[model samples]
Target: MQAWSMTDVGKKRRENQDSTYVKLDHERNMALLMVCDGMGGVNGGAEASRIACEEFARSVWDTLSGKISGKEAVALLEKGVSAANMEVYTSAISDPSYMGMGTTLTAALIVGEDAYVINVGDSRAYHLKRRAKDKLKQITDDHSVAGDLFRKGSITKEQYDTFPDKNIITRAVGTDPQVYGDVFELKLDKGEVLMLCSDGLTNMVPDMAIEQVLKTSETPADACQTLVDMANRAGGKDNISIVVFIKD
Candidate 1:
């Protein structure tokens, strides 16, 4: 397996409130990938994303051992999300400046031939088959108002694209006392790629353009850098983050 990740503050953002993580264990045929995008006032956004990402990764690292099963991988990722959410929530309530801080968490755990994915808020995971002509498959659902409206047929595609409150996410990692993440499992075959990214890239670049990059890039690192450049070139209104893993 091979993995690569990148995060950028973008053109307009004052600071980068995005965090990412990637770990690969060849001996065990395992990998972990994560991306987080924070929201709040002052420095709370950055702090929230940093803490949540670290705590979530720590939780998984502490319990993950040799030869994990699909069920076990799911449990570990779920626990990691819970741990991250609690840590962020505690920090938010304890500090006055971070009272309402929250962040999106999208993660994937690859063990053997299966990948277990967990997500909250709007960050996403996508699956692309290297040898097939299939279109990119988004693995997670957005938890924002516009996403919900569009999914439920309450809003047309054109209206969703222009929705003013599209960025307002309904569910997040640390906004509530307790949080749950949506879980999904998929097969990860050789030469296939799985990507985890923040809305920064999605909001700026359309899916078709992103698919083109993933399909043509020579390597995961190149794809990451190219995607970041593309997002920045397209106005870069938000902090951008991307993490990719290829089953080699």
Candidate 2:
């Protein structure tokens, strides 16, 4: 497995509030990709995101280094997320400057031909599988309030298009002491691609556009840049971060 990642402040945002990490345990055939989008006032957002990513990476690395089964790896990922949440929550409470700081997290771990996905808040993990006619299909759901409203038929297509606060997420890490995340396991095949990104990219570009760019790009790095460029062209309203992974 191979991974590439990129981050941009975007056209409108003055600072990047997003952070990402990609780690590959080649000897164990394990690969991990994590994306975090922070929320707060001023620098608080960036700090929250940085802390979450760093803590998660450290916890995962330490836990996976010990003797454990594949299932244990999944559990460790969840534990790492919980630890990160507590760490951020405590920091926010202790420091007046970082009050109410929070962040959305989404991660993917690849072991052999299987992929494990963990998500908190609106950050997304997408699996693109090739289909007939050389097409690709997306295999993840957005976790935003807008997404829920769209699914429940409460919001029409026109309303969704113009809806304010469309990026508002219903769940996030560090918002509360206890955070629950969605976990998924899937089988990976040759030519399949996994994308983990902040809402900034998704808010500006649709799934089809993402598929088109990834399909045409020569490498994951190019695909990531194309996506960022497209988002900035479409009016980048927030910090953008994305990681693209290809399974060999």
Candidate 3:
């Protein structure tokens, strides 16, 4: 089991409001990966992401033990997200500066041969099977205006790329009293890869290019650095963060 995570304040952003967490249980071949992208003013955004990422990771770690069933894993992931949302929402209400702070969260838990995922807002989860060719599957849906338009076939890929409101997300954690996460369960055979990332990478790097790097990179660390570098080269415009793990 191997995992790597990286975060960068992109060329155009004054601060990096992205946060990530990775916990690997080598003995059990289990790993937990999470990424959060915050939206708000400088302080609010950063704080929101930090709180959400930490709370979720901590909650899961507290209860995670040896082997478990798929159903139990999904319930634990849901509980973690709920705990994170409540903490962020509470902090937002308590502080005037963070009144409207919120963040997008994408989390994946890899246990044995299966991966359980949960997502809120625009951050995403992706899967790539080592034996498959050119098949990089996106596992989460974006809760943003442009994302909705593109999914509904109301807009072309070109239009979505240039959409003025592309950055405006419709759903987020900590923005309201309650937030629901989308959950998914998938298999992760040996040598397969699972990734969680903020929008900075997706917005700047095309999916095909991302798939190419994942296919060619030798290790999770290499893939992470290469992707971040590529995003910067493509005119990094936001905070970029990625978490990648491979079942070796």
* Candidate 1 lDDT by residue in tens digits, 1-248: 98999999999999999999999989888888999999997998999999999999999966786877777888888899899999999999999999899999999988888999999999999999965477888999999999999999999988987789989999998989899999999999888889999999998988888888888888899999999999999999999999988899
Question: Which regions of candidate 3 fall more than 4 Å away from where they truly are?
Answer: none
Pairs in clash, predicted candidate 1: none
* Worst 10 contiguous positions by lDDT, candidate 1: 61-70
The digit string of per-residue lDDT tens for model 2 on 129-204 reads 6443455554556667887898799999678756797877888889888997888888888878889999889889
What tens digits encode model 3's per-residue C-alpha lDDT throughout 61-90? Answer: 768868999999999998998999999999
Instruction: Give the local distance difference test score of model 3.
Output: 0.91
Q: Among all windows of ten consecutive residues in candidate 2, which has the lowest summed lDDT? A: 130-139
Judging by lDDT against the true structure, name the best candidate. Answer: 1
Ranking by lDDT: 1, 3, 2
Candidate rank order under TM-score: 1, 3, 2
TM-score of each: 0.97, 0.93, 0.97
Worst 10 residues of 3 by lDDT: 128-137
In model 1, the Cα lDDT at residue 71 comes to 79
